[model samples]
Target: MRLRKPKLVLIDLDGTLVDSVPDLAYCVDEMMKALGRAPWGEETVRGWVGNGVDRLVMRALTNTLWDDPEDDEFEAAHPIFMKLYAENTSGRSCLYAGVVEGIDYLKGEGLKVGCVTNKAAAFTVPLLKAMGIYEKFDIVVSGDTTPKKKPDPMPLLHAANQLGVKAENCLMVGDSMHDVEAARNAGFQVVCVPYGYNHGVDIREAGPDAVIDSLAELKNLLK
Candidate 1:
């Protein structure tokens, strides 16, 4: 598919630009251990992602102890998870293959690059800084930065507005249903990556404008 030179490009963080499951799983394990619960495997934690920390913690608690965590339990676990996660932010995290070159190529093409992620700003900032790509984006919007996250289209639309671009002139690149749905709702083009986590669902089934195995393919498609 040929894409017009985008005035703005909005990228997702987790499971899109970066493979953050390792660090996420580590935090989940640590949180469970703090609660005296058995640890879950990485694959199990992978299935619990994409929703948000509250849902992730609840899912992890349910999987490990066979009981859903109440709001209070999750509240107690939240800070512990954050503390452990902040310490291990980049311990097991790494950018997806070709993500660096892809972003660089887009920037070189004069596209206004931005990040719209469901991750909280606190975690998102440090993670991007650790990955050494924090400066790549002209704007970064986190899940908590807005009243609503992806699937609501507010964040994507908001980012486009912030970049002084129309939604139709922006491209939203991500690896999950939330991304596709948000872009679709916001009247932007959407691209999906096949290798990222999508709650065990095939990303292709999410119905993006295109599905790619690597971000490098995006350069060719856009060109």
Candidate 2:
């Protein structure tokens, strides 16, 4: 079934619009090296993403998704990761297939478009610009843009507020359970893409309103 046409559309960044794992992994491995540990590589780093830089750094330092590094351990490595990531944010990142087409289609339909992600504002804007899609988004709400990020719904709700749209008039397109939960809490319709990082769990298990293989498929569902 087609979803109601929403006044504002919020898309996630990292795993959804762009495959930033290459860049993130590079930084993660380098950070590990800086801390006198071995690199986790791209495939390993891919699963640790979707949270923000802080969590990603902690995961890299601890080498587990669930474990937390001590404050001193985190403090020692977080800055290294941040510096490394700041230098390589988009060097190897690329937009996913159909991203440009999908965003263009939405713009053609006159819908206000936005990007919401747990990534910090420091990295989000630069990556979007580097990927050549910065102009496509009318507003962007990064993890730090609002007081809280995804899985809490503050970012989505903040994006809606910035776009001057009501919760019911917004739709969020993302790739993880955090997206689904956030959209639900924010009272916005949510859709998921299969290819994003979901910590090895199937995104379908998260029960988004629907799942599409590509952003290009979004238009087909939105009528």
Candidate 3:
């Protein structure tokens, strides 16, 4: 997508900046073991990511999108997963290809950069900091930072407001449809990376403004 030098660039955390499923999968399995359920494995957990921790736990419990775990079970499993995730966050996660270069390019171009993610603040903040990319961001708006998370447009809008930029002048970059839909709903341009977890669906079908393979390539596109 062509842009006239967006005033702000809001990026998604998981699947975009970080391939976080490794730690998430570990936590999911640990939580499942505690609950006496079978481990979902990394492959299954990969497809369940991008939504949120609660949804991921539910998906693990049900093993299918057509069904959901009971609320009581969810309540029981939620904290277990949270505790496990908190202990494991970023321990196995790493940045995706070209993430650092891309963030550097954006900052080098004097663009205001913010990290917007469906991951909760408790997990999001420390992970970014642990990865040494936290200070690179001008602001961070996590899933719990707003009333609603991605696919709701509230988090993106909240980031824009925090950065003092208008939604129309902001650009959203992510790896899933939630990012694209959130950008669309918030009146911002969006680009998607093909490598991220789009809930096991093709991100192209979601129709982002641009489909980029690597974050580093954004340097050439941003003007």
Each model's C-alpha lDDT? 0.87, 0.91, 0.90
lDDT of 2: 0.91
Best by lDDT: 2
Which structure is stronger by TM-score: 2 or 3? 2
Can you list the residue pairs that collide in candidate 3?
Answer: none
Which tens-of-lDDT digit does each residue in 91-138 have in candidate 3?
999988899999999999889999999888999999999888999999
Residue 181, candidate 2: alpha-carbon lDDT: 96
Runs of candidate 3 with Cα error greater than 4 angstroms are: none
In candidate 1, stretches whose alpha carbon ends up further than 4 angstroms from where it belongs are: 64-68
lDDT of 2 by residue, 27-57 (tens): 9998888888999889889989988888898
The root-mean-square deviation over C-alpha atoms between each candidate and the true structure, in angstroms, is 2.0, 0.9, 1.2
Q: What TM-score, computed on C-alpha atoms, does each candidate reach?
A: 0.94, 0.98, 0.96
Window of ten residues with lowest summed lDDT in model 3 = 1-10
Comparison by lDDT, 2 against 3, better one: 2
